[model samples]
Each structure stands twice: as structure tokens, then as C-alpha cells.
Target: MGRKWHGQFEGEVVTDHAEYPLRGRLPGCRIKHRMKRNWLKMYDKAGWILRVETVINDPEEFRVRRRVRRRGRRRTEWVPLRKSVAYLFRYRDVSLQSNAQYLNALAQVEDPTAGLRGLDTITTRKRSTKALNPVARPDCQLFTALMSGEYAVHGFANRDLRSKLAATVVRLNDDPRRQSAQVSRLLHRLHVYGLVAKIPRSRRWRVTAFGQRIMSTSVKLRQWQFPANWPSCMTPSKLVRKNRRPNEGRSYAPFSGGPSTSPLRLVTPAIACATNSKLL
Candidate 1:
């Protein structure tokens, strides 16, 4: 939950409907939040056991000082956690603290089923009679933006939310009026969908209890669950380690069927990368 791994995790949350075995499915769910390469993960077992763990991929983040004897005198020096097993107690303490903090955060959240209907409240068309489905497109993106950590505790106003969506979901060049109108429509749908509720006589809105669970679950599903079974895709990188004078002449020939000493071309970093079959 810290900023270090805030958006670095790459894993999936298995929904109840997801099938595992070829013949029969298991009762409880196996949820995993993992970071690629580093393999940091938090998972549950037997419906009651919960464990929070992470690799010390970067020892500096958890490094501490320890006392050591030098020349018959005791002094403290920075002890890199990854470099020695002597600091295993400190490591265990930090891990337990993380687990406790995670549990405390979960305990503070009200149960989704506390005196309310199930997630069907969102799937149903009763509230959202219009075709404005938040689970899709611009609407979905807006929902994700609202679910940002800062908004979790204190909700948001349309004006405050606009800043988050602009230049990401909404075009930065768009006029202010257009941006406001778009956000207004999206927030309206959220209210109708029972995912958010407006404060009395105020423009502020906060996520409903049911919405907390649904949106959180949906985000996890979209990020990891839906693509869990898909074949892994490789990223193509082009490495150009050339250094040339800016005024030097260059050649262009791929399409003309002949090499020609062309003038040095001043191009954007993007175009330069594109010319070399790379993406900057």
C-alpha cells in the first residue's frame, strides 16, 4: 500500500465465478497480489489465514543501523538488510507490522453486506435505466480515477475530480465547459448506479458501502483477472547507442531503393525513436 509499490504490482484477483478445476471448483477463493520479477505477494488461505509478504528487492528501503564493536568500542553503522542474516529479527518485525497494518485497514472498512443488497445492485438495470453503463469506456475510467487512494477517505467534488481525469481520460485541450459536462454525466450515473451518494445539499460525493467492494473488485478484475489466462506478450525495445554531431549529414534509403546522403533531420524524440523501430 506504500507509494513504492503503489502501481507496480502485476497479479490477479480471482472472482467467485472464475472456474479453476476442469471438473469441480474449490469453495473459497485464492487471491494473490504479486509484483512482477520481485515476486512480492499477499495471499489468503483456509478462509482465515492471511499473510502479507514482499521481497527486499531494494534493501535501501528497509535498511537500518545496528551496533557493532570496533576496536573495543561500540558504534552504530548502517546495516544493509539484504547483505546479512544478522538483521533477521528486524526483518521479521517489519513484516509483522506490515501485516498488522494491512489487517487494520481492512477492519476499518464496513462489510459490503451490512444491511444492504449484494453486488447485483450494480449489475441490475433498475437504477441505471439509461445506457450509461459505468463498467465501460469513459465511465469505467472515471470510476477508476475516483478510486484513487486520496479520495478513499474524503470523497470528492466534480471540480476536484476533474483535475485527476483531465489529460488522462479527458483531452487537455478540451474546453472547461465540455470537461465539466462530461464529468457531471459520469458522476450522475455513479449516483444512479448506487455506487456513490451525494452529501445533503452539497456537491461532494462519497462511495457507498456496496460501491467500495464492487469498484475495488472490478478494478482488480480488470487489471489482472480478465487477462490471467491470456498468452504473455513481449515488449520490443530498440537500443541505439550512437553518438553523432548534430550538424552531420545522414542517409535515407529504405524506401527509395538507394542510399542518399540526406541532410541532418531535426526530429522529435518520438520520431527519432520511430525511425529506429523503437518507442521512446
Candidate 2:
């Protein structure tokens, strides 16, 4: 008989070659072979090997897909649940806060009076609204110019203030022309507020002490509230005097023409008469 492989066998020991064939291995060998064959068939049918390979190649892709599926399921499950209009308005308040921060920064550098201008842009019907009443245009612009000390008198005459404010509005919304109108209105309002004083003879303006105080307070408040990560754009004031003369240039010139001697010593009348007769 051939040597049998060493392993535990269940049930009766066989002695007859005709019943068990000692040299032909075990009877249940076929069963074990069938089990392995069935396992491989199931594995092939499931394509588990390919699935594992795809997962290994790009794990994040699968994770993203899974997240999307989860979100989709949650959306379907929770969309029916609704919130109050007041809650929605809260978001609007947050948006307004962000806008306020931007406007405040612009006021420090561009124009504090821009708020008045923004208010003027809204329709008259909307004038009573909280957002519309926050600030005036001229005030914002004047404050910005004062803080930055960058205002040009020429700009006021040419309506460049409106242009600058229009550009700012364009960054936030469409229809810049409408924004310009609003800026003009705001400037007019500033005249009402007495924060901005317009020179009648020329298209120029100067900020009042009250306006300066307001701007200072606004800047301090904004700095405390927003705490921007960027550095401030403010510059120190410089003392400038045009056509300044140096000490040496200011010194008086010495008395012109050489020193004088006392009336050319005598020979006075006599010398004068003799010289005159000789010439004749």
C-alpha cells in the first residue's frame, strides 16, 4: 500500500482494499476538492478580488462617493423639516455684518461716508429700513480721506468720489451706475448730518471735529470687532512746508558798494570852479 498523508480521519478504520483503496487516498478527498472548487467559483462570481484591487488603487475616490451617498440620503430624510423666517433673517444679519466690516475698512482708507451713499442708492420707499439708515456716504468718504490723508481736492470737483464708491459697490453687486447715484445721495445726506462741510465757492470739503471724533471711534470699534489679520494701511502724518528757505538763504546781504570816505577832502568849491573853467 502507498503511504497515506498524515492527518486525522473521522469514523471507522478500513482494512479491505476493495472498500477504501489504501493507495487511492481518502474517499472524502473528492468532497474536499468540491468544497475548494465551490469556494473559488463563489469568489469568481462575486469579483471580490477586483473589488479589493479597485479600493486599494484609489481609496479617497471611494470615500468621496460614500460621503456623497450619505449626504444624499440625509438630504432626502431631512429636507421636509423646515426653519422659521426669523432664522433665515439671522443669516442676513450675518451677511450685513460682513458688509459692515468691509465698509468700515474702506472708511478707514477710502471713504467712511460711503455708508450714506449706499443708503441713498436704495429707493425712497426703502429709506426707513434698518440697513438703509446705518451710515451716510459723505461721512464715510470724508472719514476715509481724513484717516488716510489721501483726499485730492481735484477729485471732489470731478466727481471722482462717486466713481470710487461705484467701484466699491461693483465689487459687491451689479449695476454700478445705480450705486453712483446712491453715493451722490449719501454725500447730500452728509451735508444734512453736518459731518461733511462743502465749500460753496469750490467743489471741496472739510471734515468737522465731530466727524473726526466719529471716525476715530468707528476705526477703534472696527479694529476691536474684526481684528483683521492684515497690517494697517495708515501712515504717519508728515510736516510739509512748501518753498522753505534755509537759514543761510534767509541771512541779509551785506551793504552794497564799497565804504564811503568823507566828502573828498576840500579843494571843494575852489577846485570845482578851476576844473570847470579849464574844461570851458
Q: Which has the greatest lDDT?
A: 1
lDDT of 2 at 47: 22
Candidate 1: segments with Cα more than 4 A from true spot: 1-120, 126-128, 131-137, 170-173, 231-280
Q: Give the alpha carbon lDDT tens digit for every residue of 10-117 in model 1.
A: 544232222233235334333344333232345444456655665555544565678878899999987555646877776666666656666777789988664335
Q: Candidate 2 on 132-210: residue-level lDDT in tens?
A: 2223443344446444455533325325565455433223235666655665565566555555577668766666555
Cα shift from native, residue 212, model 1 (Å): 0.9
Clashing pairs in 1: none
Candidate 1 structure lDDT: 0.60
Show model 2 residue runs off by greater than 4 Å.
Answer: 1-146, 152-158, 167-180, 225-280
Best by TM-score: 1
lDDT of each: 0.60, 0.38
